[model samples]
Every structure is written in structure tokens, then in C-alpha cells.
Target: MGGRRRHARPASADDLLSQLGRLTARVREEIEVQRARVELAEALQRGMLPSTLPTAPGLRVAARYAPARSGLDIGGDWYDGFRLSDGTLAFSVGDVQGHDVEAAAYMGQVRIVLRAVAAMGAADPGEILRTTNDLLVATDNPLFATCLFLRFDPRTWTVRTSRAGHTGAVWARADGMCGVIEHAEEEIGLPLAVMAGEAYPVTEYRFTQPGALALLTDGVVEGPRFPLEEGLAAVARVLRDGVAEEPETLADRVMEVAECTGHSDDAAVLVLSHDGPEACQTAGAAPGIV
Candidate 1:
């Protein structure tokens, strides 16, 4: 009988190369899509912040917002200031518990609710925070945020402030002494969304001298290698040296300190200052944004 002809299997090298090429192309395409999404998210977050700070009759306001160094990893840090019809200057600073698109979206919702509640004639900062917390709980939002709200009465030169598990406000008096605002343990409330029925208490600070109040996010004082107290001490030193006369300049100085200390997270600072009765002759600059 004739020997069976030897048979050879076809080579698969070309097919393998083709499959690898398709996979590489698909991965590149997906990366581009993700990059685009991140860029859009960053833009949205920037848009949500205050474009221009309102001009109060007797106060100068300046604010700064900086994103994290990680490209497109925009966090939930935010600052806002607006004048109510009743002549109350309302300002706020907050940080949601995330660094993604969803966090940014939730931040927008929280900001809107707070603004709406404040505009609805809720003069108390604590009440606005409580109402916002209730709305978040009612909507079943899973995100939580730490915030500081302030209502400054330019006419009376008094400030009513509230905090929800946020960093304390800092102040520099005309005498060049600066320190962090302290609250009783019972006065400091939990962060919003921790529970549905949380209540935040309000604190009042009346300025008797020419001074400035700074509301900031924890990123300013919390870092990988730095302790919160150490960061706060550094800030106090800067303030003791006397901040710049201009609000924007003071904001820049605070951020400069944060950057020089190698802070890794986003930092925001909002400053409101008054000349007091002694220096009432000096006029505040026109409305501005930074």
C-alpha cells in the first residue's frame, strides 16, 4: 500500500499578530475616550465655582481655587460668595468625599441646594446647612461633604458662621496676631449626609479691630508628611507677618505657603476683611475675581 502523504498544519503567526494589533488599537481608543471624559469633568467643576465675588458695602473678598496636580483628577473642593437682598454676604467652602466625576456632580447639587436655601431667607448658616443635609438625605445621595458657611453683615460688622466637620476658619487681627477659630466639641457637628437628622450649630464672631477671616478646605492644612497642627502653625506665622493689603494678595500668600510646604491635595482660600471703624476712610477695591 502507498504511504500516506505527510500533511502540514497552517502557520498561525499572522493571525496572532493581527489579533494583537486589534487589541492594541482598541486599548488606545479607549484611553482617548477616558481622557476626553476627564477633561469634560474638569471643565464642569470649574464652571460650578464662583466666577466673581460680590462686593459687600464694607468688606473686601477674594478667593482662590486650585485643582490637584494629578491631571484630570479634579476633586470636590469649592468656594462661593453672594450678596442676599437683605444685605447679607453669604460665603461657603466645602469638600465632598471623592475625587471623581460623580463627586463633582454631587458637589454641584449640594452647592445649588445651599444657595437656594440661603436665598430663601434662611439667615442662619446652620439652618441652611441643616436644610441642605435634609435634601441630600431625602434624595438618598450617598456622598457626604464637610462645609463651612458664613453670613457676614456688612452693616453691623458681625459674622455668623457654621461648620460641619470642616477645618476651622483663620483670622488675622489688625494688631498682627493670627490664629484658628476654636469651637466647643459639642458645637462642631458631623459632616453632612452622615445621618438624615443632623443639626449644625452656629458661631458668631464680631470684629472689634481691622482684621480678615479666611475660610479654607482641609487640603490647605492636611498633607502626607505634615500634621494638621503644624500646617495651622505655619499659616498662623504667615498671618502674623501680616497678610497683604489686597484680598487677592492675601489669598495668594496663603496658597503660596501651602505650595511651598508640598501639599499634595487641592487647596482653596476665601478671605473677607474689614478696615474697622478706625480705618473706615480707606475704600475697598472694586468687585473682582481670581
Candidate 2:
């Protein structure tokens, strides 16, 4: 038995204060690290994206990107447009399979690969996706991406599109009619990098009059507790109602759904509008520029 009962002294105020200071400092350090990561990821993604969309006479292009409100706000979603050697405009929207910095890095790699492949004369949208897929698979990085690539010929007002595990686009006509560019389930191909060789079928649609075509990543429409079909319908409605608006204005209106739904993923939209040959003539546009 103990000869005397032992009593533990309470921690002094100074000791408690010191511990609190250390804990606070640790937390602040962690917060700074997280902030740094977010900044770096954002910079990487922005740098990879096109600073200016390629412009043509009869066609107007505009794009918008919104990072996820939750978590790091770093995502693999990207949109790009450039003028091909043939003077046609190529626009692409893609989403890589993650929300971290690694996903952002992978996104840059995929984008660069696609642009390079397109520049190398992969004229067909399907061929562009296929070659880009092959190069991505060669990396063996175990990440996949879904892409929608469209080539718009301003002269003929024809749009050729290919999809890789991505959602269909929405199109609105000058007559105020709008519809989603849904593909047959069997016709759609797997996302890039799931296999070494895959086929992405192409779909073609023509714009006989002035209208708008919208391509977006899944995050713009799908989210937890939000049905994808509903989102598509909502986007179609926006396009139907706002078809005559400026591309940038229409893009902002389309993005409202993503903001309202409170999606946890990043959202991106690229809108291409054609103003008809008459408008081009009135604007004194050059040939092949459209």
C-alpha cells in the first residue's frame, strides 16, 4: 500500500497556452499547404487551357470553366478550340478521371496529345480521339478521360462530332428549336485509356441557318442527387430559349444550372454560334475563315 496518497497537479496556464499555440501553428501550416496545392493545380489547369479561342468569320466561339466549390477546386475538366490546317475550327471538351492535382496534370497531357494529333492531320473527329487514346494508353498511367471533339466547317455549316464516354451535345436552330445530340447506347465508345485500341464513331449534323451548338463536360449536368437526364433537359431548355443570345451570354445562362444544382465537380461549357452566310457577307468576312 502507498504510504501517502499521490495527487497529480493540473496543467499550468502557461503549459496549456504553449500546447494550444503548437496545435494552432500545425493547423495553420496544414491550411497553407492545402492553399498552395489549390493554387498550383489551378495554375496548371489554366495554363493548359487555351488563352484565346480561334475565331472565324461566321462562327463565334466562347467558353466558360468553373472549379468545384468543394474540396480543392482542382479538376480534370478542360475545353479547347483551335484552327486546323484546313481552316476548319476544332473544339473539344474533356474530363479526366480525378479531382486532384494529378488529374489536372493528366488533363494537360491529354489535351496536348489531342492537339498534337489533330495538328498532325487527324482530320476525322473519330480518328483524333482514337490516336489521342492510343498515345494516352502508351503512358500506362491508369487514368481515363472522356472527350467530345467537334469540327465545324464554316463554309458548309456542317458539324462532325465524336464522343468518348462523354455526354451528347445540345444544339439549337435559328427557328428556335433545340435538341440534345444523344447517341445510341451501342454507338458510344469507352473513355480514352481503358484499352489499347477502341473505335469512336462519328455523328454529323448540319446547321442550315444561324444557330448555336453547345459542348460541355458531365459535371455541367450530372451531380449527386441530380439526375443526368434532367440536367440535359434543362440545358436544352436554356439553348432553346436563349439561342439568339450572344455566345458568352448563352454560356453564362447555361452555367446557371450547374451553380444552382450545387454540383461537387467542375463544370465547363464551349458554345459555337453561326450567324449564317448573309451575316458573314454583311460583316465582310473572308472566305474559308468561317
In order, what lDDT does every prediction score? Answer: 0.80, 0.85
Candidate number achieving the greatest TM-score relative to the actual structure: 2
Q: Which residue pairs in candidate 2 collide?
A: none
**Candidate 1 off by > 4 Å:** 1-27, 278-290
**Please, what are the lDDT tens digits per residue for candidate 1 over residues 71-138?**
64768889999888798789999999888888888888889999999989999999999988888888
RMSD of 2: 4.4
Model 1's number of clashes is 0
Every model's TM-score: 0.85, 0.91
In candidate 2, position 268 carries an lDDT of: 93
Superposed on all Cα atoms, the candidates' RMSDs to the truth, in angstroms, are 5.6, 4.4
Candidate 1, residue 40: the lDDT equals 76
